[model samples]
Target: MRTAQPRHYLMCRPTHFDVVYSINPWMDPRKPVDTPLAIAQWESLRQTYLSLGHTVETIDPLPGLPDMVFAANGATVIDGRALVARFRDAERIAEGPAYLQWLREHGFADARTASIVNEGEGDYLLAGEWLLAGTGFRSDPRSHAEAQEFFGRPVIGLTLVDPDYYHLDTALSVLDEKTVAYYPAAFSPGSLAVLQRLFPDAIIATDADASVFGLNAASDGYNVVLPHNATHLIEALRERGFNPIGADMSELLKAGGSVKCCTLELRSAG
Candidate 1:
């Protein structure tokens, strides 16, 4: 049976949430965005974490950074050390320094901005002692080496093939130290082979679930929070002894993010 663990997370309110420019397949400038509704949805996520005994910390939202609500892209925090992101898109360039400053001011003395293009936890996820790094769209391949050096973990590089799953967090989620849930088609043949060798018993998501950002869920060892529309994944998670909590990230999904996108786990050293 899976046991729940209390986690610490960093979040940013969707105070200025909007899709003024398109960066991914899910975003469109012509689509109407309701800032208030986005905030409400984000709040529900934060509250869900709080009710589950997870600590939630917030960073003030900058007016011009509409995508700031997707806090998981800000930085990768492990053992109290942070590697801030260097965004691939010019639209998110300033986010790097903003996240760096937050880390520095918030007691992360070992934090430093990444020299190469990498969108923080959006591409870097920790599974046991392995650091799963993703590239092909947002993060550069070289950043994988940098993350290995910074975090002192064996980095396993994975290539994302689908544009819809631009970030690794969008196509895969680390369910626990030893298990993960992913959509196989989003990865390249080589990456898929690597995953199969590494996690022979991983939970596989269908196209119907992955299409609704289901793989972007977050797990606290036991409870998996994902998009409500991802019905298949919900049942799959339950069959594996996980408590699946359905969340409504429809408003946020318009910009290519859901639960995991809004939550950045702050892993500290023992």
Candidate 2:
């Protein structure tokens, strides 16, 4: 179960990518984003997943919803059960409906929709059998209870204090069923203590790597797809027997997301 094998994933083409507004600390509307470079970078990631023998599907991009390219925010799928997102911000409110429509039309017609304000996989991450849900930022803690009830899984609500690491997926990555990598400073004292207790052997990322959104990386149990700037985290992962592969997602970082943000795992149907 811990071995690396081909996985199913969903991605969105960065056709209208841009940083027109600042939702997180990493975003700056004043900073110019290279749309073409972003597209190429997203394509490279998509191809990387394909090269790894993973199935890569896509969602059609909407014109005005620039952040829709971060498909992981659209929904969180586990064993074919999709918990569609309900974005907290008004700017991204339209994205939830669009993604839900796609899921309904696709194979996920039976997927359950969310009533609570949640950012889908942006705040909810599946690590092992537990659902690690982040709060105190984009998502509400009320959504955590809702997620737990919907999935019938234990959900741990962690509070994020830093604006730079607004999302749980941005602060922590579920490398395998047992192993996780995270940035301690991004979480509150209580949340950090909880993480330490839950994952005693978790890889701790330094400020240098965390600053580059290294914890936002994704793993297929065997290999880790991370940002190229996260040299420290890359070396750390190598020490743990994981093959760390770096991707140039700097263009997408302007929108406060990286590899994991652009990729959503569609677990095999049970």
Candidate 3:
């Protein structure tokens, strides 16, 4: 198989009911949330995406899973080849099946998880023949190799050093057709060398930037997704001739997710 990278991501719409620990009473959680700021952020995120000339698809009446916004967390798409994920987190296992159903309905071949053990989709990246995966924390090694075989790819397993950089999306992303955004410290020395070899001119994010908005959040060729008030990082991105696009994802972060988590691109993702 060839390297598969997303050209566009599928973002869902959020309502009071869709949010984890949402204001809605029906969806059970920590309690009714006072997440007005998160709501505002989501609106701005929608706007920022539109400004970039991309249409945002809303998954109105969002379904099961406590933190389902990480759509990419549950679905792995290779050349439009859909493999619905099976999350280690019980709360999010529902999302993978849901995505699989979508693929079946749309005339696509779908794959399923063997058990309730695979980690979230953010832990994995389809980098060429090697499946760059985060092996510690949320995603484990057992499932990592399993995913490689299922996709007919080699697994370049990377362990997460700390909790903050828990997911691959939080640390690494393809910034453009050639460049990538990454934080080497979060990865093991071997994986760090691997990424550098793959993307020689990659932008290594500052620790401050990664914590602020997840440096490798989302990207569309030269365009990238970031959080609000990322003035400094935005400047750096601009200096690199990148279009730093901001989106509201306060609610997503509250649930341990973000713009990068919200969607998974299918079709010719590269």
Better of 1 and 2 by TM-score: 1
User: Model 3: how far is 202 from its true place, Å?
Assistant: 1.7
Residues 1-270, model 3: lDDT tens digits: 123223545655554424444321223455444456655666676677677676565543255544555567766777656566776655566666766676666556555654435554587776545567776667667877677667777777777776677778777776655667788788888878888887887877777777665564666666778765556667777788877777656555656667777766664433
Alpha carbon deviation, residue 215, candidate 2 (Å): 0.8
- Assess candidate 1 and give its lDDT: 0.94
TM-score of each: 0.99, 0.98, 0.80
Candidate 3, poorest ten consecutive residues by summed lDDT: 17-26
Regions of candidate 2 where Cα sits further than 4 Å from its true position: none
Candidate 1 lDDT, 1-270, residue by residue in tens? 899999999999999899999999999999999889999999999999999999999999998899999999999999999999999898888878888898899889999989999999999999999999999999999999999999999999999999999999999999999999999999999999999999999999999999999999999999999999999999999999999999999999999999999999888877
The alpha-carbon lDDT assigned to residue 30 of candidate 1 equals 98
Clashes of each: 0, 0, 8
lDDT of 2 by residue, 179-235 (tens): 999999999999999999999999999999998989888899988999988999999
- lDDT of all predictions: 0.94, 0.91, 0.64
How many clashes does the backbone of model 2 have? 0
TM-score-better candidate, 2 vs 3 = 2
Clashing pairs in 3: 5-269, 5-270, 6-269, 7-269, 13-59, 41-248, 45-248, 73-121
Candidate 2 residue 267 C-alpha distance from true site, Å: 1.8
